[model samples]
Each structure stands twice: as C-alpha cells, then as structure tokens.
Target chain A: MTAFQPDCAVVITREDFSQDALQAEIFACGGSAGALATFVGLVRGAGPNGVIEAIEVESYPGMTESSIAAIFEEAAQRWSLLAVRVVHRVGRLEAGEQIVYVGVSSLHRREAFAACEFIMDYLKTRAPLWKKELGTGGAWWVEARDTDTEAAERWGL
Target chain B: MKIDVLFFARIREQLGVSRLTAQVEQDITLEQLQLCLAEQHASHWSEVLGGENVVRAVNQVVAENDQVLAEGDEVAFYPPVTGG
Candidate 1:
C-alpha cells in the first residue's frame, strides 16, 4: 500500500464526484498504497411513487467540513489509514445522481475496506447533512433511520 | 447576552425563517434557548425544535441540551442527520 497524503479532501460541493478522478488521486501518491477502497452512494430511482423525482441535501456549512474531518480522524485512529477523500453534494439533485463519495487508501485491502466502511458509517449520523425527498406528493424531510444509529453504535461495542 | 439562532432543512421550513438574532438577557442552556424560541412564536415552533431527535449545535459543533450558551454564539437547530 502507499502513503495516504496528510491532506484529506472533505468537500461539500454541488458538482459531481468523478470516480476516475478519485482513483487517480489515490494512485498519484505512488507505491505507498496497495489498496484503494471506494464507496459511491447513488440516489435510487425507486420510491413509493415508483420514481423519485429529486432529493435535496442540506448541510450546516461551518460545521459540515469540521465534523467530517473529525470522523475521518477517528477512522484513522481506529485503523491504519493512508489517505481519505470525502465529497458530498448539497441542494436539489435528480434521481440517479451521485450523492456521496468515500475513498480510503491503506497498505492492505482489509484495512482499506474497514477504514472506508468505518468512515461511511460515521458519516451517516455524525455529519450534519440532512436529506429531503421530493416528489409529486410534496417534499418530505428524511429522518435518521434507527438502523443507521445502531450501525454506528456497533463500532464502539 | 445576545446569540444568533440558525435553522436548517425541515425546521427552517416549519419556522418559516432561516436566521434570526435572539436577544438573551442572561446566559442560558441550549434547552432553555429552545424553550424561549418556542414561546416566541406559536406552539409549532416548540413542536419542531423540541421534537424527538432534534439536534443542536453551538459554534458549528454538535452540542447537548445542557451546554451553556454565551453572548455572540452561533447556535443552530435541526433534525437528525440522514446522510451517507
């Protein structure tokens, strides 16, 4: 595995997160990393109405980046993390759009996979991003699922 | 002491305003501030912010109800996170 650059990109943009670009970022570090694990969250088209029209993501500006950075730091402490990249989109987005991207690099596949998953789990609850599902019926703000909170709890136990 | 209050997402929609300056004669806990806000408007304000799983933040960090507030603090209220 190669070294994870000391710099971790924690961005909350309205643009797309290119997988090819993210892959290049990890490889750019050279031989210090052997495993690059990535997770891409896409907006699902299927909803109760059969098609999700759009999903609006909201974030606490000043807190969003700092909170995600803290989550990444915790992941690094729990695992052997070489580098990390997290980019989340806010505002109105159409179905099938990429919602989030989480990439982690480590020396081994196991660590890389664990770190990536760990970061994702933490992001679900710890980050200050909120979601609102919109359709013909009107807009509904998404609530945190109990299953997600449970998933975060398991990490400590 | 005066503090800035911020709202987001559903809470913002319910309250009908995004940001407001709250005047506080004295320091108060986040819980107290929430109650004060609820009293300012109709009962729905309390129903939203005081609702279950509502999250609070002070100065851009997650905070508990017991956290004390100070002058010029930026406090935000919103629902539970639903991001991945």
Candidate 2:
C-alpha cells in the first residue's frame, strides 16, 4: 500500500491540532506561485433549530480513513488541485470548537476554492462519522438534511 | 456467533447503547441483521434502520445489503453523516 500523504487528509482527536502540523502541510505543498485557501468548520453547541449543549462524534476506524482518502483523490482528479488537507475530529466537542478543516492550494483561485468546497460537501454526506446533540430537555441525534444531500449530489458523487 | 453492533449519534442516543454483542445467524447479511435487530427491539429499531437511506458499515467499511458477516465483526448502523 502507498504511504499516507503527509498533507492530504487527517482524522484525529481534538487535542492533536498543532501549529507545526499546519505549517508543515503548507510547506509541503510547494506551491510558491499558487494561492492557498482554507476552511475551518467549528462545532456549535446547537443543532439545526436550537442551542446545542454538546455534540458527540463517532466513526468507523479503518473505513473512515479510506473513505476520506478516496474523497481527496476524487477532488484531485476533478480540479487542478496542487495540495489538499482535510482534518476531522471525533469525540465529545463543545461549542466554538474546531471540528474539521479543509485546505487547498492551486495555481489559480478557482481550483483552490472549488476543491475546498467539494471536499467539504463530500465529507458532509459521505463520511461515516455520526453526530448527536444535547440540549435543554434531552439529547437527540441530528437528522440528515436534504440540503446536505443536495450539496453532495451537486458534485455527482 | 458473536458480533459487535454499534450505534452512533442519534441512533445511539435513541437506543441508549453504544455497542453490544449480538448472536446472529452465520453468513448473515446487512439486510438480515437490520431485520433481526428491528424484530428484537419489538420493532422500535425500525424507526432508525427501516428506511432505504439508512447507512450501515461492516467491520468499519461501508457496506450494502448483500455484505457477508462473520464472527467477531463490528457492525454499525446510523443515518447519513452530516458533519463537515
């Protein structure tokens, strides 16, 4: 099997985020002339309708990594992407915590922008992670939204 | 045989269990497991696993209805992911 790419995608616990990893990823892309764009998704202590008390995320270990790798590969094939990074956190998270990050570098802004968006859309609907929300009365699982499905389908995946 | 069944996010909250050991028929398929689980819960499980869109994973890999099973495998059922 091929070695995992250092700057491609990562799934780790919240405590593992480091400045060094981010910088190393940026440097590894070797895109001095390209524009780098990033998107960071934070956890909000609420669901679609109300304030969220807490959220729990779960995933299938080996499968999660493979699926994410495939998503990145697809994104790379579809756009003029130079480098892409995706980091997702699993476990208990509170409001305002970073949940996922997507970074892309390309010769032009369009590919970087589109690749970032595409990775996020694929992650939202296709990834195996699951999330539950805790609120005032009790805890509940967040329902799948049609909007998410639509966004993912827009990529034809 | 003993298989690990996992529920996550909403389904876990609803069922109130994270994982459990289940004894299912040999060569069980994902569809059969869902039906059996639904029946075991007096059909309450149907609320989560009944629909066509619900997703399943076997041994940490996303699977379809015809996926085969073996002892000691991990099976998970949950709704489509919405996380970023």
Candidate 3:
C-alpha cells in the first residue's frame, strides 16, 4: 500500500512557464489522478490603445502568492483534487506571451475541470495583480471587468 | 504608531512612489489612515485614493476601510485585481 500525498504549488514569477513541464508534474503525482485540466491566459494584441505592444504586470509580492494560495485552498475544499499548480507572470510581457496558467488534477474528469475553472475565477478577482497595456498610441491600466466579478460571484464563494 | 504603506500599478505611478512609511496615531482605522494621507498630500492624492473602487489590504489580506491598524503593519492600496 502507498500513501497519497496531495501536491499544490503557487508561483508568481517574472519568467515564462512550460505547460508540458507543469502537466508532467500533475501526471507524475501519486499515479492516482485520472484527469488533468489546464488554462493559459495570454497577452492580447488589441485593446483601447488599438494595438498593444506589451503589458506590464504588477503585483504585491507577498500578497500575490498568498491570495492565489488561498484560492487554491478554497478549490481544494470544494473538490477532490490530487494536485494543483498555478503560475502567473509579472513584469513586462509582449503580445501573445503567456500571462497565467492554472492546472488541476483529480480522480475524475469532473473534479479536475471544476477545480481548474474555480481557481481561475477566484484568481481573476482576488489576486493582488494588475496589468497595464502599452501600445503604440499610449499606455493604460487594465480595468476590472464586471463580467469577471460576475463569473466569480456565480461560484457563490 | 508607524506602518509601511505600499501602492501598486497605476496608483503607484500616479503618486510617483511605490512604498512609504507613515506615522499614524495608535489604533487608527484603515479609513482614518487613508484620510490622514490624503490630507497630507492634498488634492492629487485625495482624488487617487478616494476612488470608490480602490482596493486596500492590511497585513496582506484584503481589508475593509474599518479594519484597525497596528504598529509595523503593512498596508497596501491599489486598483482592483485584473489577473487570471
């Protein structure tokens, strides 16, 4: 008989992440996970500035990690998760670059899918990170979207 | 009491300072601290900090304006989060 040790990691970094590496981590966890779900957000090229050249992400160092960890904690409480990983990039990122990633693994497909979306919803509204879009025309801070708030609220958390 | 104050993103750029130390009275509410800072910096800061949607935190937890402050606490102000 073997023990099942759940794995969870939250990272806020300036460097890029490898989806294959992250997925491999989940696949290697305990060998009990039957499903894996992942989400990757990218820097878009279009905005109010017409054509965004890049985005500068800013975050409160300690709070950023803690807040995302809290979101993962909540997801764990609601779902049967075997593993979870979140990586969000800070500082300057060019268009089409990956900005964030959320991955979850569970005993079943449903749990993995739900936990991934749940973590992302909470992270969008609760994490202490902000984005500023820089374009050829000018630069502006990205505004909080009501749709995001609504999506998070739908979870009733 | 004294506390460290932090600002991020647009608010940091508007204020031209990322972090600062504030001298405050003992047992000041977060709201009171904000008002004190606004009073010291005047109109520009008042306008920036007074925005209805400005988010605040105490000791790294999202906090309401009425949250009490203590010495050595870290307080942060910034726009609502937009990350995924």
Candidate 4:
C-alpha cells in the first residue's frame, strides 16, 4: 500500500449518504492500494409485515460514534488496511434508501474483503443502533436475529 | 447514589420517555436497577425491560446483568440492535 487515508473514515448521519463521497474518500486515502471493496445496505421493500413504508433507525449518539471509531481501530489492528469508510443512516428512511456503506482498501483483495466483512459483522452486534419497520399494522422494532450474532461469532469476536 | 437511565427504540416507546434521572440505593447491580424501575413504572416497562432479548448497556458497552453500577453511570436499555 502506498498512501493511507485519515484514520477516522466513519460517518453516522440522518442525511442520505453520498456514495460518490465514500468512493472519493477511499480513493483519496488509498491511492496506492491495489484493491478496494465496498458494500451498501439498503431498506428492502418487503418485510414479514406488508410492504415496508419506511425504516426508522435510532442510536445512542455519543456511543454510536465512539463505537464505530473503536471498531475501525480493531479492523486496522487485524488487517493491513489502507483506508476505510463506513456510513450509516438514522431517522425515517424510505424503502430502497441506503442504510449503510462499508468500504475498505488494502494491498490485496483478500485483506480488503476480510476487513470489510469483519467491520460489518461487528457493527451489527456491537453498534448501539436500532431499527423499526413502519407499515400497515403499525411500527415494530426490528428484532435482532440470532443469525447476526452467529455472524459476529464467526469472527471470533 | 444517583444515575442516568436511558431508553431507546422499543424501550423508549414502551417507557414513553427518553431519559430519566434516577436515585438508587448504593451497590446495586444493573439487574437490580431494572427491577427497581419495573416496580416503579409497572407493566409495560417491566414487560419490555424484563424480557431476555432486551439488552442492557452500561456506559455504551453491552454488558451483563451482573455488571455492578456506581453513581453517575449512564445505563441504557434497548431491544437487541438491528442495523448493518
């Protein structure tokens, strides 16, 4: 890896996250990296209830930011990452709206892939954010699935 | 001792308040505090916070019920997180 981006590439905002900005930041931070990996999470239109109207995300503000930063620090320790950026949305979001983005850059494709997945996994279980689905019957807080905990466990965290 | 209690997501909806300044007896474990709140607030609060799935966090870190508490600690109760 040639150049590394700034350490804190994480973002937590209610505003619609700009993919272009994420790309630019990663590229600018990891100009020397040979590979860059990206993942974007979106709100699905269909849920167990009727079609979803929107998703409302809530987080403990100070904890949310600090926890994301702490996770990035862990990813850095585990892999030779050049740059990373994570953006998560909060508040009411329409179906198809982008909910999260995880971008990582590394010298090789494998490291980048591993780090991206690792961060996403940890973020799910470790991050202090919650989701509620709004639809016909009413709004229901999205329940955390054991599958997510299993995913996080796969990382041995 | 005094502490700050916070509720989020489903817990917030159930409790109908975002934050509360609470006074408690000394050396209470987090679980004991939950019981105290439930007795004070009644059904919905007990039903939500009492559930096994509702997670407790002490000072922003996910913690066990046995975690000890001190004055001025920030405690949060919320449903299991659902975010990517």
Candidate 5:
C-alpha cells in the first residue's frame, strides 16, 4: 500500500494532456505499488466518409467534473488502488489527436488492469461529454453505442 | 416557479440557443417541463425533446423524467454522451 492520489483523479480540459506527465505524477508518490496501467484514447483519422478532419468535444462544466469524481470514487472503493487519473479533452480536436487518458496504480497487476479498464468503461458511459465528428461529408454528432453501455453494465453499475 | 433549461451538443444546434428560462407551476416533473417546452415552441422543440432516449439532468445530476424539479433548478436536455 502507498499514498493514493485521489484529489487529481478527474481533469476535464480543453488543452491536450501529456501522458508522460500524468505517469510521472502518479509514480512520484513513492508508492509500494508494483503495477501501473494506462490507456490513451485518440481521434481516428478515418471516418464514415473519407479522411476525418476534426472532432468537437463538448461537456457539461459542473456535471463533467462531478461525474468523473463519482466514477473514480467507485473505482477506488472497488479495489485497493494507489492512484487514479483521468484527463479528458473537450474542444475542437484534429484527427489523430489525443483525446483522453486513464491511469491506475495498485500493488498487483490484476487490480491495476481491472481498475484501469473499469474507469474507462464508466467514463465513456457516465461522463456528460459528447463528440461531433467533422469530415468531408459533413459534421454530425456521434451517437451513443450500445457496446459502450454494455461495457459499463458488465461491472454491475 | 422559474427554472433554467439548457441544451447541449445536437440539441443545442437544433434549438439554435444554448439556454432559456421557463416559468411553470411549482413541483413540475422533468417530463412535464419537456412537454411544456414542446408545447410552447411547437414542432421545433417537440421533435428534438421528444426523442425516446434524450438524456436529462436536474441541478447537474443525471435524472429521470419523473424527477421533481424546483424553482431555480438547472435542467439540461441533450443526446446520449459519446465521450471517451
């Protein structure tokens, strides 16, 4: 067990996030944890039409932070975690740009991996954020997928 | 009672406005507010708010249509979230 970084668990911003910086902050806590897992979500270059241009990400200001906090709180309660971090970008992001980051630290690899995955699944479905894909054809709001809902539900949420 | 109603993403584009205040009877359920907006704005608002899966929130909390609303509460209606 080590010092857990729960205060920085949720970050919703318009600026791009640095994965290395986030990882550094997590490990800087000098925890006895043996494993750290991270996931980064990027905007794809391909779209339903042709090459994608950019995507506009939108979120509810007050609710977005609260939602992320609630999600990370659940993960911390579910596992013996050392640290958890989530950085989600909201604004106009070009294709291939980094969109999100989810990281978890724990004493064992299994909890680290499970908590990382769990945070991502819940973030996708619970966060009050939306995306609109822009491309040659036109811009359209990305619809919620059933697969994401199923992913979150699998955790008994 | 008056409450602030907000629209976001696709719903904001469809409505051509980000937010508006509505006056209604006290203790209106979330669903009633939607119907009232649809009734006031007619087809334009109806088509957008009438969707089966439109997400709603009260005072920044994800809420059901049955949730009771109070004066000065903030209500939001939008499409299902797609953030990663």
Candidate 6:
C-alpha cells in the first residue's frame, strides 16, 4: 500500500470542522470554480418521536474507516464527483454537536448536490456506526429505521 | 481457545457491554458460539441472538454460518446497522 494515499474521499475527526481545510481539500482535488455542497449531521435532542437526552456513537475501530472509504469509492464510480469528505465523531456527544459531515465537489451543481446526497444516503444506511438514545425515561439503542433502508434502496446500492 | 466477542448498536446497549473475552470450546463453530452465548445469558442473549435476523461479523467482516473459529479471533454480533 502507498504510504501517502490520495483519496478522492477524506474522512477525519477534529475538535471541529475547519472551513480552510475543506476549501483546501477542494482546491487540492483541482476542483476550482466548481460547486461544492456539504451536509452536516448533528446530534439531535430527540429520537424517533421522543425527547432524547444524549446519543452515543460507536464503531469498530479498524472496520469503520474501511467501510466509509469503500462507500466513497463506490459513490465516485456512480457520480461525476471531483472530491468528497466524510467525518464522524465517536464517544459521548450532546445535542447540536456535529455528528457527521459529507461534502462533495463537482463541476456542475447538480452533480455536487446529487453526490453529496448520495454519499449521505449510503452512509446512513451502510456505515457501521451504532447509536444509542438517552432520554427522560432511560437509554436505549435506536432501532434501524425502515425509511433509511428505503432511501438507500432508491440508489440501488 | 480464546476469542474476542464484540457487540454493537442496540445489542451493546441492551447488554451494557461493548466487548468480551471468551474461552470457547476447541474447534467451536460460529453457530456453536452463538448458541453458547445464548445459553450462558439465557434472558438477554436469547433476544439479541434470536433467530436469523441478527447480524454477525467475524474479524470485522460480515460472516456466515460454518465460518471456522480460531484462537484470538474476533466475533461481533449486532442488529442491522442503520448509520450514515
């Protein structure tokens, strides 16, 4: 394997997101003058129709990165995307904290938007992260949502 | 033989554990381990490993029945993942 791999897709976690880093990444991919779209997933204070106190995210250390990278590769093959980025946080996170980020750049706005949505759709359904909801009553693991599966199936993945 | 068992998602919450180390029987099959776990913790394990809906990954890769076991292998069990 190459020591320094150039990924059309990048995944990371910092104290917070950096606009400079994101912009640099877009330029690094030689994607200037193109439209860039992003989606920032936040930890919500509610679950499926209920109040949530906190949400815990968990993932297999070695497997999560590989899975996310694989999804990025598949999306690149499916869309006319120039660059993409995905970053997710683990451990105890409060509401409004950025849980995940997906960014896509393309020459056309349509492609940028489509690819960003595609990546998020795939990630929501396919990523190996697990979530637990803490609410007034107690804490429980959130069940897999059927709507998410349907959204992913719409993409034929 | 020693094997590392991992739990994720709802199963982890229900069990209140993320991982466990087990000394399973020699030449134990994956199915056997599942059954063993279910037997050990009859109440919760039965629900988590109930039937065919549960997902299993061996060594971080999705696995099926008949997957061979070895010492120091990692086996994980969880409900279907719904992440993005």
**Candidate 5 at residue A91, lDDT?**
95
TM-score of chain B of 1: 0.94
lDDT of 2 by residue, B12-44 (tens): 767878888888999988888888888888556
Count clashing pairs, candidate 1: 9
Q: Could you tell me which 10 consecutive residues in candidate 3 chain B have the lowest summed lDDT? A: B38-47
Displacement of the residue A131 alpha carbon in candidate 1, Å:
1.2
- State the lDDT at B39 in candidate 6: 83
- Please provide TM-scores, in order, for all candidate models, with all chains considered together: 0.93, 0.82, 0.95, 0.92, 0.94, 0.83
Error of 4 at A128 (Å): 1.3
Best prediction by lDDT: 3
lDDT tens per residue, model 6, A79-136: 6677777777777778777778787777779977887888788777776777777788
Top candidate when judged by TM-score against the true structure: 3
**On residues A1-157, what C-alpha lDDT tens digit does candidate 4 reach at each position?**
3233335577789998788888888888744688989999999988888889899999899888888888887787778788888999999999999999999988889989998999899878878888899987888888788888999999887
Model 1 C-alpha lDDT per residue in residues A1-157, reported as the tens digit of each score: 2233334779999888898998788677565777899999988776765557899999888699998888776776677777788999998889899999999888889988988888788888778889888877777877678888898888971
In Å, residue B71's CA in model 4 sits off its true spot by: 1.9
Stretches of model 4 off by over 4 angstroms after superposition: A1-6
Candidate 1 Cα outliers beyond 4 Å, as residue runs: A1-6
Residue B46 CA error for candidate 6 (Å)? 2.7
User: Which lDDT tens digits does candidate 2 get at residues A75-122?
Assistant: 766776667777788888888887888888777798778988888888
Model 3 residue A47 lDDT score: 82
lDDT at B23, model 4: 88
Return whichever of 1 and 5 wins on lDDT.
Answer: 5
What does DockQ come to for candidate 6?
0.68
Clashing pairs in 3: none
Put down candidate 4 lDDT per residue, B41-63, tens digits, no spaces.
Answer: 86777788888778888998888
Which 10 consecutive residues of model 1 chain A have the lowest summed lDDT?
A1-10
Candidate 6, after superposition: displacement of residue A65 in Å? 1.1
Q: Residue by residue across B31-71, what tens digits does model 1's lDDT show?
A: 99988888888888978998887888999988999999999
